[model samples]
Target chain A: MNPPNIIFIVFDTLRRDICSIYGGDVKTPNIEEFLKDSNIFPRAVSSSPWTVPSHMSFFTGLYAREHGVHEDLEHGDGRVLDKIYEYNGDNIISYLKQKGYLTIGYSTNPWLSPGTGFDRNFSSFTFFSSEYMNLEEMNAVNEYKRYGKNRYEAAKNLILSGNFQEFLKYYRIHKRIIKRKREVGYPFIKGSDLIFDHIMNSSYEEPFFIFINLMESHEPSALWELDIDDRKIKYLDLSGREIISEKKMERTRNGYKRSLEILDFQFGRLIKYLKKMKLYDNTMIIVTSDHGQALKEKRKIPYYGHGNFLYDEIIEVPLIIKFNNNVKINIKNWNQSLVNIPEQIKNSIEGSMDDYMTSEYVFSESFGPVHDFETLIKEGILPSDINFSLMNEKMFYPKKAVYWKNYKLVLNGLTGELDEFTENGKSQDPNEKKEIVENLKEQIYIFKGQESFRV
Target chain B: MTQEIRIEGGLSLNAKVAIAKIVINDAIDRFKRPFVVWSAGKDSMVVLHLVRNVAEERHMDMLPALFIDHGQHYEETIEMLDKISKEWNFKVIYARNEDALSAVKGNKIYLKDLNKENQEEAKKIAQPGEILKDENGEYFEYSLETSVGNHILKTIAMNNAIKRYRIDALFTGIRWDENPARSWEVFISPRENPPHVRVHPILPFTERNIWEYTFKNNLPIHPLYYQGYRSIDGKYDSKKTSDKPAWEQDLEHTKERAGRSQDKEGMMEKLRRFGYM
Candidate 1:
């Protein structure tokens, strides 16, 4: 028998408990139907709380420490391209390509774009902008941010700057975006529909690998003015510059829920098309997330976004796997790390289905703040009084977690101390369960190879 | 090759000592009726001295030390245990499995005459051809060299001691660099079956760190270690790896447990899973 074709989907920033399949409130009816023939891993953890490191783990089956594609104190992605070029030859994409599988990738995340090494071995890779960012929309947002408050002044400033054609075009795009926001109750961010549309239109060879990343459930949640920038929000959230209002959090969270509903409808369309194309039975489909988003969840520190925190809201993600031919497999209640995806795919290709994805120990990692706060301050996105040095020192500690059965141990790399020890999501005193903490800490040390651990 | 535990990689002798003391204080604060597992070796002697310092700080009497007497200990080990406990003004509890020891006849122990616990332990751990049967009953050799003998004689004996005294925690001097199975151990670990915790205050200490602490504190050195044996275990099975003292030998390139029984060391993971320290 031929090897199964693979369809890997990542719902960027999708939380597990929020989905109905994992016993959450959000009604993912399409996901519920998919679960009938799928295995749902309730305790799947992403390797990092943000995009670059988590996606690298998915592609390479190694932790962020191993790949060295992670964020540090002052820079977010300065060395991404260099690291990817250096290590891309040994990843799952190259492995599958060598195995005679035609690999293709589609992503709406800007970080996973073509030049960033995320598209290395793909036969074809495309980055779909979440929102329609034609040259006109870019000018409109830039012009709006430049001009203070009045629309006429912005138009006057643009025309005075010898950009009259650009001014008229920007005005038209600005009006259209506002009208679209009024109609849809949210700003235009590309959803799963764009990827599904492309998939339906394209023709592929047998035994192909399809990778897709959908960004509908990400931030910029509620309806926004065309001038409201994501970088401003990102800076404020990650730097803890401002205490977000509860009302704003509720609005953003509700918008996120609505986005999930839209995503479910779009995903339902893909399942229908796969069945119509007669590829449903022979295709191996996996739907998971890179990481989960935090909606001002109350933690040791209130978490509003991903990247810096190791809280449960940020690391726990949803995992749904539908093996080819709808194989009946036992799903053990073990913590499954996303780093094992590559090996799981290899085992499936070799027709080894006996406890193929079982993991005795799973891990997640985060190295300080993912954004360059200094740049944000210089760009006027944040206030100069943000205490940049203090924030960097406080948030720059490399945090890692090790999960075994029901217990989790979060260790701080800087002080060599236990940050938090929890069982089944409730914090326990480390003094009480020192054995479990030590065991999990040992796993974390081993997972992070000794060379990285020393540094 | 086995991966090295890098927790103690860049730490200085003073920093490692501070961390070990913190672990010891945490064990004292959490567990009542805690006891130190002393083998009269260099590592445990350092732990005992650290515990004495902490006790002096808190103005409370130090806890007793647990010496596992499996009938295979050297006379020097027993003498050190006696002299050190008296000099340090602490008690020493002898944890001996007398039934298993008394069943030894010639080189073999008759399994039928052993206690139910020893018989069950022998049945589980004794390899094929090791347990022989006569017309009377089954029998296995009385030795501490094999995994079965260690589990029955050492682990089972230690577990019975825990049950007898209701020790909430047992502090030991097992270092991460000591054995492959012990590399992943934490400062305080909970074990089951007999229901107690294993407090490893010096897990992050290396061989060199152990010696540095020994000399800095001017603690008593195990006679066998000074006589060239790096690791002093059962008298019959352990041999000297070199003619020089342990600290004088090549510590980094050589394995520390080279003198211990290979049969027991090879199956350390299995032995540990069954509650052996």
Candidate 2:
């Protein structure tokens, strides 16, 4: 008997709410259709808020404490890789490869490319350059310069010019110049297209494990065919410019929405191709994200991003597992960690794994400081010098958490407060913070074997 | 008058800092030939980072670490081990119990494997002036080959490597708080045997302390912690429960019973019945 083939897909920085299946506003029909027959984990929490560590955890099944590649700092030396391997030990790819599986990985995130030890287990791994920007033929840099200053006007001008390619070029260039200036040096390549081609062409001789990471949802949103003017928007917030007009923000959001729609369409096509090729049935397909992207929400803090803090927007992601055989499981009101996916896959293949637990407790860590730190410093509960790194040295707490049964805990690092919420997303009484804090403190003190520290 | 108070139990901030600094310093001092008993968990990663930092501080010696791999581990454990080893130049030794067990099964009966006949014979021989001896009337001579089985037994086991290197001292990044077995462990201890000593430089450290240290020092750590894992032990528990036999669950049990946990004794007995001890 042959081992089962595995197809793992990670949409980079995709928020859970954006998926139609997760009760978001986006019209992700393809994703919704995929989820209908698949095992969807509605409450899958990411291992980390960033690409490097989160992806590492996905492969190794060990937390950052065990595998040791927690930060995105480029040590500029090869020693960092050595440390990662020492902690993670053997990777799943190598194990699968040893078991006669062909492993391949493709990613658009530069951080997860070959140099990062992510390539260690895969027989073949490829990272597409960010230069290609999008499927549109326009260069990202030029597009930004043309329309980024005044998005509405620029978009209007491109529309009037009646050149869709010019509009795409403007959008790509604006996106590239605005946020990812460092990547401008690299050439562009259409990663999604490359991946689609690979999937269609790869040999299925041995059981194959293919990992694909797409960065279409990453910030500085770019889209080629949004029904909006590119010239009327103002993109340069860096030049001491006035605040971006509401119209521009709206257009940006609209463009992002349109891009997501396009991605969904492409995904549908890929799925259709897989089914047509008769490879969709036996494959154990996993769809998830490294982490969710923050779309500028005020969670006591007025900004949106993942690396500097932990929040539901950043850590909570949609996890969908679909097998060739139709097996239906409705996992409601259950909080599952993404780390359990590998074990679940094994269980599915071998029929000898534990059932998903009910009273599961999830843990998370962040090395970088968040708004909670500022709050703590302001209240004199923590010293000003107690930054993210400093706090991480002294404590281990998730930035945001949802319990298996909906007893949620959100630790605001900046405020030094742990807020409790009901499973229905209702906030608990403020008085309950004290008890939660006390329990958390006790757990920390006991877990660390330190009896001297009192809360 | 000055209080002249002697601080007991709780460590001061300065003391904590000093201890942390010493950990870093000691790690740096042995940067050239640092080897960690990598268990693919959090404590071990802390140990790995200390060694990395030490090697970086020296700017001359390249520290290579090693992990004695037990065969039965989670998939993530192996992934992390391979990932970290590739990134940090750590040498991994994946030891297999099957081979070791096969090698020693033919010649000897480990205490756990003693059959009823052997038990009765040993009991009879111990009687006053009964002359305790093997069936051949000679002193019982047990060898590794005879006891463990020749097919599985190797001359030099993974445990023996530490002794063979004449290691100045072996460092383990074990924290007392996480496990009851380690809660009372001291920072450093002399091994009962020569040429090997056990050191827990991070014993006094907390999870937060390690994270803070790594963050402040801009040290690298595994990312899974950020996702929601408290520590790196791969065994996922449905709930935090104490399931071990009462006697085997605490230090007092080991002290009372010749260095064996009651759970271990039970396991040994089971293995003995199966002739695999």
- Candidate 2, after superposition: displacement of residue A169 in Å? 19
TM-score of 1: 0.63
Residue B268, model 2: lDDT of 29
Lowest summed lDDT over 10 consecutive residues: which window, candidate 1 chain A? A446-455
Each model's lDDT comes to 0.80, 0.53
Stretches off by above 4 angstroms in model 2 are: A72-88, A133-190, A222-246, A330-333, A352-359, A369-404, A412-416, A419-423, A433-437, A440-455, B1-268, B271-277
* Model 1 vs truth, CA RMSD: 12.0
What lDDT score goes with residue A444 in model 2?
29
Query: For residue A150, what is the lDDT in candidate 1?
Result: 43
DockQ of each: 0.03, 0.03
- What TM-score, computed on C-alpha atoms, does each candidate reach? 0.63, 0.52
